[model samples]
Target chain A: QQQVKQSPQSLIVQKGGIPIINCAYENTAFDYFPWYQQFPGKGPALLIAIRPDVSEKKEGRFTISFNKSAKQFSLHIMDSQPGDSATYFCAARSGTGNQFYFGTGTSLTVIP
Target chain B: NAGVTQTPKFRILKIGQSMTLQCTQDMNHNYMYWYRQDPGMGLKLIYYSVGAGITDKGEVPNGYNVSRSTTEDFPLRLELAAPSQTSVYFCASSYGNSYEQYFGPGTRLTVT
Candidate 1:
């Protein structure tokens, strides 16, 4: 039960719209959850993360809403622009392990 | 500082050929990891290192090897390249057990 399943393999949103991507994990032992953003040919970068204790976190136009009871977390981009188009990955890790389990990833397209 | 750096951003190998993918971190992170990303598969951990002289295999470690002689360097070796080994390799580093990780640009290898 070490999998993190992400939904909507791909998504398309108009400019200035709000785009949301969801992820659910099967392992409740996972205490740390993080989201990463990757461009076409670049490495994934740490976008924002939330701990089990926090229900939500906001950084700029990016926000992460986490639910411990539901074993789910989501990333929301407010006023998404064309530049925001990229692949997003959700990951989880247990408190005792150095390994991070990643989701299949979602390809997002923000059209102008 | 170059958080995490990988060499030979791209490579092509013939069957049975061997090569080493070099990784280094200037942040002096205690944790270093190697991951492979395939289309729609997200990132799969191949190996990880907690500190100098310490290394361990991850989910997919077959046909691969790793060495951690220094805290700043963690290299992955492919003794015999195969078609299945063709994927984008990424190196990441973290200061502690925290979920936040810094990733390199990634090295794309194609085995034919």
Candidate 2:
């Protein structure tokens, strides 16, 4: 099993449009969820994250909507701009802290 | 703070060659990790260290080795480089197991 699965391997959105990426996990033991954004020639950076106990988290134009009962989570980018075009990944960690599982990743393109 | 730093931004290795990818973090994080990112696949953990002198294998540790001699440095070694091992490597560190990880700029390696 993938452990964590992300949908829309690729996405395209116009400037000022909203781009949403969804992810699901099969492991209920997972308690922490994180999203990473990576640009060409660089490493991934933490965009946003959420815990199983929370329903949503918003940081600037980025938001994370989490549903523990459904074992799913999604990232929403409001006012998507060309600068937001990059590869995004969703990852999960079980228990307190050992290793984490990652999704396949989604490549997003924002057109001007 | 320099966050996390990785050396050898790019390298090309011949089959059977050995090389070391160096990583250092100024954050003094207790948790350090080495990950490899392939084209379509997401980042895969190669090895991790919870503290100095302690290291553990991750999902894809087959051809790699790691050492954590101090709280700030975690180096990954490739004993025998292979074409299959060609990919981008990332180093990350977290203050604790429950905190967000900070990543390095990443090292791109190509084995031929």
Give a tens-digit lDDT track for model 2, residues B1-112: 7889999999999999999999999987999999999987899989999999999998999999999999989999999899999999999998889648888999999999
Query: A29-106, model 2: which lDDT tens digit per residue?
Result: 888899999998888898988988999999999999998889999999999999999999999986757888889999
Model 1 segments beyond 4 Å from truth?
none
Please provide, for model 1 over B8-102, each residue's C-alpha lDDT reduced to its tens digit, 9 standing for 90 to 100.
89999999999999999999899999999999899999999999999998889999999999999999999989999999999999998868899
- Model 2 off-target regions past 4 Å? none
Task: Write model 1 residue lDDT over A20-89, tens digit each, in one string.
Answer: 9999987888888999999999999999999988999999999999989999999999999999999999
Quality class of the docking in candidate 2, CAPRI style: medium
Candidate number achieving the greatest DockQ relative to the actual structure: 1
User: How high is each candidate's TM-score?
Assistant: 0.97, 0.97
